[model samples]
Target: MLEILFEDDYYVAVNKPNGLLVHRTRIAEEKKEFALQILRDQLGYHLFTVHRLDRGTSGVLLFAKSSKVATLTVKAFEERQMEKLYYAIVRGYTPPEGTIDNPVKPDKDHKHKAPQDAITHYKQLGTVELAIPVGRYQTARYSLVQVVPETGRMHQIRKHFAHLRHYIVGDKRHGDWRHNKMFFDELQSPFLLLHAAMLGFEHPVTKQYMEVHAPVPQNMARLCTQFGWKDVLPAAVFPPASEAL
Candidate 1:
């Protein structure tokens, strides 16, 4: 079942799971399930998607209850009135804080695609070093970072991080295959580490400020615990004791 993080008369948000598509696409034509369809079925009503999350990324995804509401919310995003927060585990120990103002191609399908302006600000929340060795490195190192993208370009965070040479741990397309192999074989984590942790926007109906939060996946949470970085995660990421394992 999709975890509903926030809902109102005008909109609803869900904690979309990794590997789930926001909707059917030619790239993933063989896929059978989608977040939009599942949520529509779960609520027994129609939904209007305001944005999208990559199939390999998970976290707060919003939908409008109706067409009118969808229009309003979409405008907010275009105007940069919405705030998006993400959590990512990337290769190597990142600096305390940094910004990536690199440009990225809108899509990889086009050979001479025009690059769009993309900026990502990140703060390092934690770091860990493992004795495990891979490739030329004697040991492995990684950092937990909170990311806030100033622009909503497709694959912005992934591409920006790659430009910085700090690839996200499980990003198959733009990551270090060596580190990905190490994470899968040694850490038992084969899922993308990028997660949409939270979203902030004005209520389309109420015109009031609001924020929605999504808990990190259990695998991601487990890694934080092992790295002693659980304290850095927001309290909203944890469910009640009854819901926890």
Candidate 2:
């Protein structure tokens, strides 16, 4: 069952697990389970998706309980009224903080078409070095980063990180195969390390600001523990509740 993070009369959010599709899609036809169907069945009511997370990503996923709420919530997302936070274990050490401003095409087929603007801001929370060597490096290095994408595009965070050459660990499509394999073999974790840790937006009906947080997945948390980062990582990713939205 999906973990319910927050729910109310008009909306519901879940701590989506990695490897679960948000809904049925032509890309992965063989998959039998989906978050949409599971949540609907579990709640005994139809829910409309306000946004989406990649199948490999786990974190706060919101759903509207009714069509009206869905429309309003979607508008909020499109207008950039919502703030989303993601945590990632990335290759190498990222800058203490930076922004990626690059335009992206929807797909390879649209390579010649005009690209849409994509921007992402990130902060390095912690770093770790492992004895395991990768590529030409004598030891492996990784950083935990808090990422906020200002403009949403298909795989924006993954693509931007790859562009910067700091690929997210376990990102198969746009990541370093060697690094991915290292995590799989050494850490016994093949799942993507990117997670949607928090979501903040205004209530459509009440117009009250609210924020919802989802705990890091066990696998990622374990990796943090192994890296001696269990304490600092969460403090950076999940800030104190007193921090205003």
Candidate 3:
């Protein structure tokens, strides 16, 4: 079942799981299930999606209960009033904090031909040096980071990470193959480590400011515990004060 984050008269928000689709799409056929369908079934009423989360990323996804609110919420996103925050496990120790100011555009190099104009900000959360015996002395070190994007672009976070040269741990399409193989073969993880952790926006109906938080999924939590980092990582559930509703 999807974790209900916030729900009310005219809208609902949820923490979507990794490997689950936000809705139907041509590229990723609806093989398993979707957030929208499950939410409607659970709530016993239809809802309209105001925004989305990546199929591989799990976290806060918002929906509108009424078409009137949905239209306004969509405009809010288009006007950049809504804010989204994310967290991800990367393959190595990153800088203390940084921002990827580069504009995301279509990846002319990629055959799939995805869109662009993506910009994101990232900060180092904590470090985990799990030197698993892949073959020899070449064990690995990884870092967990929190990401907030100003503009919502397709594959923005994944594409930005690759541009920085420290790609996310399990991004199959945009990550390094050697590390991916190592983590998959050794750690037995099936999905990307990226997650959508939080969403902040103004309620269209009530005009109240809100920010909803989503906890790290089971797999990422397990990884942290396995690496002896349960307490080392900062509190994800309790966001910073500025972001608090």
Candidate 4:
């Protein structure tokens, strides 16, 4: 069953687990289950997706209860009125904070297509060094980063981190194979380290500001603990509005 993070008359959100598709797709024809179907069955009502989360990402996912609400939310995203934050464990230490302003190709199938503008801002929350050797080094290093994407593009975060040569741990398509194997063998973790930690937007019907957060999943939390980063991973990625004020 999916975990409901927020729900109301016109909208609903869930903490979508990694490895679950939001809905059926031609590429994943063999899949028998999806988040959309599961949530709809659980709630006994139809739902419309407002956005998407990669199959390897786990966290806040929103759905609209009606066509009108879905249309409004979709427009908000297209206009960049919604704020999305993600947490990723990347190989090697990242800068204290930085912005990746690079253009990315729209799809791998169309590699020759014109690249679209992609901008992601990130802040390093913590760093760790492990004794496991990887590549030419006798020890491994990693960083936990909070990412805020200003523009959405296909696999923007994964591609941008790879462009920086700080590949995300367990990112098979755009990560260091040696490092990925190290995590699987040493930590028994074979899942992508990127997570959609929070989403902030306005209520389409009420026009009230809102923010919803999904706590770090256990797998990532365990990895953080192994790296002595337990202190840095916050219980809630985004504080309540009252606490922020």
Candidate 5:
């Protein structure tokens, strides 16, 4: 069953797991399972998607119960009325706090199209160094960061971090191969480290503000605990001590 985070008469939200598709797409035609189908069947009602999360991302995904509500929710997103918070572990230490203001293509195929404005604000939460050699460095360094994307663009966080040279761990498409291989071979963590931890928006029908939080997945939680970063994450999203690993 999907892990539900929030629900109401007009909308529903779930903690979408990594590797689950939101819906059918030409890129993943062979995939049989999707979050939309599973949640619709589980709730026994038709649902409408308001936004999308990448297949490798796990976190709060919201859906509207009706077409009208879906339209309103989508409008909220386009107007930048919704707030999203993401957590990630990257290959090197990031600035204590900084905003990455860069433009990115809409998608991989849009090379000829003008890039769209994309801004990402990030705050470093914790840092760790391991006595392990990979490439030229005799030690491996990483940081845990809380990220807020002011402008939602395709792969903006991943691409911006890549441009800054602090690639997100396990990001196969935009990361350092040696560091990714190190985590895979030594830490046994091959999943993308990016997670959508929270979503905040006003209810379209009720006009009341709502915030939904998705606990960090076990794989990511275990790594955070190992690095002593548990205290920096929101308490609501951290798993219990007994269940974290």
Candidate 6:
């Protein structure tokens, strides 16, 4: 069943689980059902996607019941009126908080950069030191953080942070492979730690403010407990703000 976060006559929002595709793409045709199809089936109604979270990303994803509503919701996203908060376990202890403004574009063939106007606000959640016999060291350091991507671009958050050398854990393509394998095998990590934690925007039909939050996954919760972090995140996920245009 689709894990609905919030729902109303105008639209529906839900928590997208990891490894679930938002829709059918050429690369993942072999997959049976997608989040869209599953949501529609579970809701027993037609629904249109407002925005997308990556396949590996888990959290607040919205869909509209009507095409007209879908158009309006998508416009809100394009206008940057929606605020998204994400959580991830990063490679190491990152800076306290800062904005990353850098130009992003595809390289000659592959790989992209974080755009110049791109801004990502991040705050450290906590840190942990894990002991594992690897290389010349028997331990490694990691940091947890809450990230807010001010701009929505192709792989914006992933690319931007990767360039900062704070690669998101388990980001195979845009991440450090050696480290990924190390964590997955030694630490027994199932998938990436990056999660879509919150989403806020105006209700297109109601013309009212809307904010939604999804709790961290069980695996992440367990990891945090192992590190002695008991809900370091703020109780209030997305506070109301003026709609950005």
lDDT per residue (tens digit) for residues 75-117 in model 2: 9899999999999999999999999998876667557778899
Poorest 10 consecutive residues by lDDT, candidate 6: 236-245
lDDT tens per residue, model 6, 129-201: 7886545567777888889998887677888889899888888778877668887887677678888988988
lDDT value, residue 83 of candidate 2: 99
Candidate 6, residue 132: how far the Cα is off, in Å: 1.9
RMSD of each: 1.6, 3.9, 4.6, 3.9, 1.2, 5.8
- After superposition, the stretches of candidate 4 with alpha carbons farther than 4 Å from their true spots are 237-245
Where is model 3 more than 4 Å wrong at Cα?
30-32, 107-115, 133-137, 232-245
Instruction: Give the candidate number with the greatest TM-score.
Output: 5
Residue pairs clashing, model 1: none
* Local distance difference test, each candidate: 0.90, 0.90, 0.80, 0.89, 0.91, 0.80
lDDT of 5 by residue, 1-245 (tens): 89999887988999999889999999899999999999999999999999999888899999999999999989989999999999999988888999999887666667778988999999999999999899999999999999999988888899999989999998888889999999999999888899999999988889999899999888999999889988888787896762448
Worst 10 residues of 3 by lDDT: 236-245
Q: Estimate, for each residue in 1-245, the C-alpha lDDT of model 3 and write its tens digit.
A: 78898888987888888888888876668376788889889989989998887788888889998899999999999888988878788877899999887766664556476455667888887887766754353678788888889898778899899888888988988887777888888888777888787788878777889888887777777776676556645566533331222
lDDT of 4 by residue, 1-245 (tens): 88899998998999988899999988998999999999999999999998998899999999999999999999999999999999999999999999999998766677879999999999999998999899899999999999999987889999999999999999999899999999999988889999998899989789899998897677887777666666666668532221222
Between candidates 1 and 5, the one scoring higher on TM-score is 5
TM accuracy, model 6: 0.89
Which residue runs of candidate 6 sit more than 4 Å off their true CA positions? Answer: 107-117, 134-136, 235-245
Candidate 2 runs further than 4 Å off: 109-113, 235-245
lDDT of 4: 0.89
What TM-score does prediction 1 earn? 0.96
Residue-pair clashes, model 3? 5
